[model samples]
Target: MSEAVAPRAAIIRRLSITRFRGIGNLIWRPGSGVNLILGGGDVGKTTVLDAIGLILSPVNPSTLSDTDYFGRDIESGFEIEAVIALPVDSAISAQVRPAWPWAWDGKDAVVPALDGDSGEPVYRLKVRGTEDLELIYEVLQPDGSTGNLPVMLRRSIGLVRLSGDDRNDRDLRLVQGSALDRLLSDKGLRSRLASELAEAEVKDALGDAAKKALADLDNTFSERSLPVGLDLSITGGQGASIASLVGLTADRNGIPLPLASWGAGTRRLAALAIAEQRQGDRPVTIVDEVERGLEPYRQHALVEKLQDSGAQVFVTTHSPDAIAAASKASLWYVDYTGQIGPLDTNKVARHRANDPNAFLARVTIVAEGLTEVGFASILLRRALGAPLSQFGVHISNGGGHEYTLELLEALNSGGLSFGGFADDENGKHPTRWKALEDVLGPLLFRWPKGCLEENVFGATPEGKLEALMADTLGDRTGMRRQTLALRLGLDAKTFPELATAAGDRLRPTMLDAALGTVPAGREEDKGAYKSHGGTWFKSLSGGRELAGKVFTLGLWPSLKPQLLPFCNSVRSAVGLPSIEDLPQ
Candidate 1:
């Protein structure tokens, strides 16, 4: 006979939840690998994972309360159902159990008489909570038949949860349904160990006084007409049993201590390590905030390891390190309305590598570079009365002009909520840029004529440009106008004549210098136009300072018309008050 092939692990192919907690209704088709859930706070990310755990949980008599209902309306009652793909030779499948015969072709369902005719043999498990706080767990057959899901079959599914705020190391203990107990189940180890503990010879270790105390207890038991006599043994009363007391411990020096004595991070890691060793079962592990007690490096490692574990995994994280570390995963985004959808990995690859934080927000502003990000952030803060985080808005640094446009296209293709900010580059790359303009419409904001430097300086009225230059020069005591002009490759000999030129006569010259019109000296060229040797306000901090100074010099009103609309668009997307709506 051919060698018998081992069965595969069970996986949840689809999850449907209704009237549960904050989620009114949601149907999620998660990938077979890792599913990384992300969204703003209270968006029902946790509830989705909790639904999966509750429906297929091995624990008997799961708890239910009125609060578990959506909007606390128990009249509708909550229901969580899942279509699970069972392993070959699975006991719950019709081939093994015969009663529940269901199959799915990844979309439609059918009841087949033979297992080979089934596209994908699946079992539908559902849990419903009633008005009186009662829970009913059942299996739905393809033939319109229903039956109670046996606890043994549920245990075979083996769903493990490492929940957030669960720092007590409960999973590491030998509790009724703990990972350790499951790992050691069907071995009769607990009974044998308990019997040996009861037979322990304590008299040899105790002193005469202690021995006499035990003898008096035995004599009192005999006088009470009890056939059994009491002696020194492990305490088993007051709801304390040997199974509850027995747990894994580590030794340090000469003393043994419970795993709970370790730090939270170590304890959780140890528990998960044991969970991974579950015999004959490949568990679906769900972790909430995997970065909770782990450092950056460990967080990355945890996600990568879980991905390679070959069993389906679901994890929720707000950490950028954890998000980026999930290089291969199904990125699911949940909005404030409890709608869940997958974020295409190809569409979000650039951001996952460079700006993973954007994936965690409800809406993002894809800024051309550090300058645009800083400039937009200052304007948003002034308009929104708070930081961008307060409104679930994130500013992603798109690194450059072309890169920003690419990110915008990706975001648009992925159907994500985003706004864009970039310089017109004096109309460079007009085709691609105009296409983006048409796609984004009002959500796109670009400078009209030139780069950031040229726009601000070019718009400044005559004498104000001179005043702005003086303000920018700050309090450098010996820094003369002549020296500055000389550094810009202007005629060093005619500095006096140029300084006294009429109107903002020097404004255009300064803008030219900023744009690299005059250049020669290697030292001067090293720091010039664009981000290199000559441009002012090129770096992130430099741009922020320039924006602050622009406001301080009362120049914001001049630039407000061109910038305000974009700020308001971002504000509107995040449900914040617009700039025009804010108190003047």
Candidate 2:
């Protein structure tokens, strides 16, 4: 017969916040592997994490003070509540069964509840405060009854929180609850260490490499020019010396190096390593900005570790790596506004995977391609004096015209404002183009000509285009700019029917072939072709820089027919008030 596994500690079954900080009321149900949180700054991301930590803590911890209150309003109260569920077959389960008899039928491991299962012997932490500053941390006890426990006597319920390094060298950060201290507190390790003080025992207990490695550190520090003047040593499992009971330190040319001496990224990884080992039976862990300071390689490894850690992990991040690391069903999206929910479907996941910052924005602007992205970004900054972030707008690359049309359709069907910019290439397919226009209406902005390249060159004042080409493209300009103009003129007239009835026919290759005559063998002047304004513009990864160059010369006037409609449509779609709507 197989041996029976012992039941593990409790996990946070569900979390709810009411009148807490900026969150008027919110409920979050997390996934078992990794609970992903998405949002931009000051959207109450940190507030949610802090509330979880605060409610789990004992009532009236000195850390709890006036600022803990959501706001100055005395009339409304603040409350944070969480359901902590213990395994039905665990040691604590038997004791609580008599008092709290409800049994959970679903698997009680790390995975989330599918239908919000209301299990029993489960405890609730209802931490509430009033206008008079009165506060209480009340939890339901095992006896199917409620109790207001004292701060020191409160239950732990296996809650762990990891904050980013913004807190700086605080000895026992919420990140790990003193990882070094937990290791030292281990009675078994302490007992073994007590028996060993020298070579014979140290080698036997720690293996040859670890024992020799520590000895080598001591010898190296004794001989080198020292900065801290302290020899490197490992902390023993005793209370005798504080550093000895704390953790490891090594020497770099006689300078003692502690974990704190490492770079931010290393420090983060190191801290997590310590926390994982020292975590004991804790089943729930919360990490903020899980990708902060981690390199691409480290991000992958760290994500794997988090997924396999067995503990229920909840993380908030804004990194493409982080998004791709977890499944869509596991991810949740939140904005600075009150909205919070899951991605829930694979399609939502794919969309978010393409743009990690999309879920974090208040309003999403789906741009047709890289050029359009650059152009839209530039326009927003020029008009708003800041990035679109100033107006709660975020730009997502639509990948292509078809993708833009699809994304706009999704946004419209979902009743979201359909904000998009597309190339004129799609206009050739009248049926699909009309359908897309119906969905996006005035919110869709199509360049009047070929693409951004055609629109930008066609709208620019004559001499300024040449001046820009000369200044920006330098030596490569003379041939390229002239050819770029010729290509634009060729596309000036449109075909009533697309030859192939697809976007490909709209590309330069096809149009360049049909545009009457040209300069002989210009193909040999390929260097110039690469530098042509339209070709050069298409090569750029960002349009904001180009926007600056053009506007600085006062080349493209603000009211150019091509520029106005695009700007107005995008503004309306993103909920930015027109100039007339501004306060007088």
Candidate 3:
């Protein structure tokens, strides 16, 4: 058998925050693997990550201002607390082993009472900011005492935060609490460099001309009535060290290039690469807007790497590629009220596989297929006076008929507001439709009698049937007609006569061809009429064109009775006015 794998380190069991920026009160229990946060703009996704970083920041002096408080009300300062589970043999565990009283059984915090029974040791770390802008970071112990969370202990937790902006290359330098500093701490690089630089050998390394220039500079300073003489040493002035002055660089063609010279995306990847090189350290990585400045392929690859890195990761993203790449990550949905709900991955698997971007919107319209998605998106855009995204609404392809109902059920269970649009499928699965109807009410729209092809064909007026037929078959009418004639076993000369024969004969054949219900017996005969473009208006682009043509042909006024209520319900859901309330 293979050896047992070690438990992931720096796992945050639970997080609680109050009076933080843009978040009044919020609690989140992220998974040990990857916790992918998805939601609309200004939903506090970044604030959640900020709270995590602040509570565990190794920096002694964290920036705090009135704006950090919720609504700029500094009277009630913010508090962020988390119960972090540490590895038993980790350095941080050894430092806090004396006060480790709490235990985590993967769910709740437990206190061991049995004799010789000690559960997984955990710590309750908290950070509080007072009204005076003073911050306190401590660990609440079980013995009615609190201890200051020292910088050394916080650094052992290995919290690395990568923001979305361009100015995030601090980790590439040897600054205090930076990734490079931590990596070179045990090597005594600072003291060694300081000693070497202070010696006369370093000054000798300069050429004779440089040494003469330095001597002249010192003489010039003395002549100007200055009492100090300049020297090339490691120390600059007061409060300076070698670590603060040194940084990492990449060698290209025998030339050194600073990491800051790279693009934002390259710098982010380099920082993560350095963080990953730290032996025996599992960093709790928090990446905000994981898709910033990266192409789709890079974003997908980066997401996959983060998920399997064996370190607890938190990410916020608006890209579908990132969401799709993180198949094993837990999805968390944050609402407008700062309430976060963790979606069940099993239930949302279908939606994630089909249209992962739907989760990024506050309200999703689950359409039956691409046809319905295209039609609904355009119609809603025209009705809403802007794009649906302007109102936090997105129309998503539900994959198919049965999957549409499944996705709606899952969305309902996940406490996500959604609207549904699909065909009646000849009234199949009435129970499923009825169940969604009870919950969704007017937000759900389904055809009364048949599929999309049947309803549109049945609604077309007889006078407009010729234009509708021409639009349906697309260009190359002669070839399309000959193909239809061959499928129906008729002469080419009589094909036009048979195709537009009359009101009774014409529509039935067209509906059969569009719906792929021709030649009732033979399996190969099904969809035979459309095999050579007999009825081509069944695809996404075809549906969009059909919707535009239907409006231009003055058929929307008649079809509005079946479609208006759902549109108005969507408008109400996203805080838009109903059609009746809009100015005519």
Ranking by lDDT: 3, 1, 2
Every candidate's lDDT = 0.73, 0.57, 0.76
- Indicate the TM-score of model 1: 0.76
TM-score of 2: 0.59
- Candidate 2 lDDT at 296 equals 73
Instruction: For model 1, name the residue pairs that clash.
Output: 526-533, 527-533, 527-534, 528-533, 528-534, 529-534
| Candidate 3 lDDT over residue span 1-584, tens digit each | 12223366888988999999999987778898999998777778999999998988877764588988998888889999888887766565566445555666666555644563555667788898889887898887756578788788888888888898787777888878888788777557777777877775567689999999989988988999876567766664545467667788898789999887788888888888889889878899999999987899999888988987999999999998898888889998875445677877898887787677788886778889877877777677766778777888878888889888887887766554567889988778999789888877888889887866677777788777656656543564455455445545566444446555433666676555555455655566555544543244556765676677557777777678887888788777766678853222
Model 1 accuracy (lDDT, Cα): 0.73
C-alpha root-mean-square deviation, candidate 1: 6.4
lDDT of each residue in 1-584, candidate 1, tens digit only:
12222337777878899999988888888888899998777778889888887876767654577779998999889999888887776667543456564666665345654535446667788899998788888888777877887766777778778888745666777766677878878557667767888789766799999888888888887889876565566655545457767778998887899888877777778878898887666788888888888899999888998988888999999999998889888888875456777787886787787777887877777888887788778777777788778888788898888878877776665344467888887688888878777766657889887777777776566656545454353452123344346544455444445556522546665655444454444455444332331235555654665566567667767787887887777766666666563233
Q: Which residue window of length 10 is worst by lDDT in model 3? A: 1-10
Q: Using TM-score as the measure, which candidate wins?
A: 1
Candidate 3 similarity to native, TM-score: 0.74
The estimated TM-scores of all candidates read: 0.76, 0.59, 0.74
Instruction: State the RMSD for candidate 2.
Output: 13.1
- Residue 308, model 3: Cα distance from true site in angstroms: 4.2
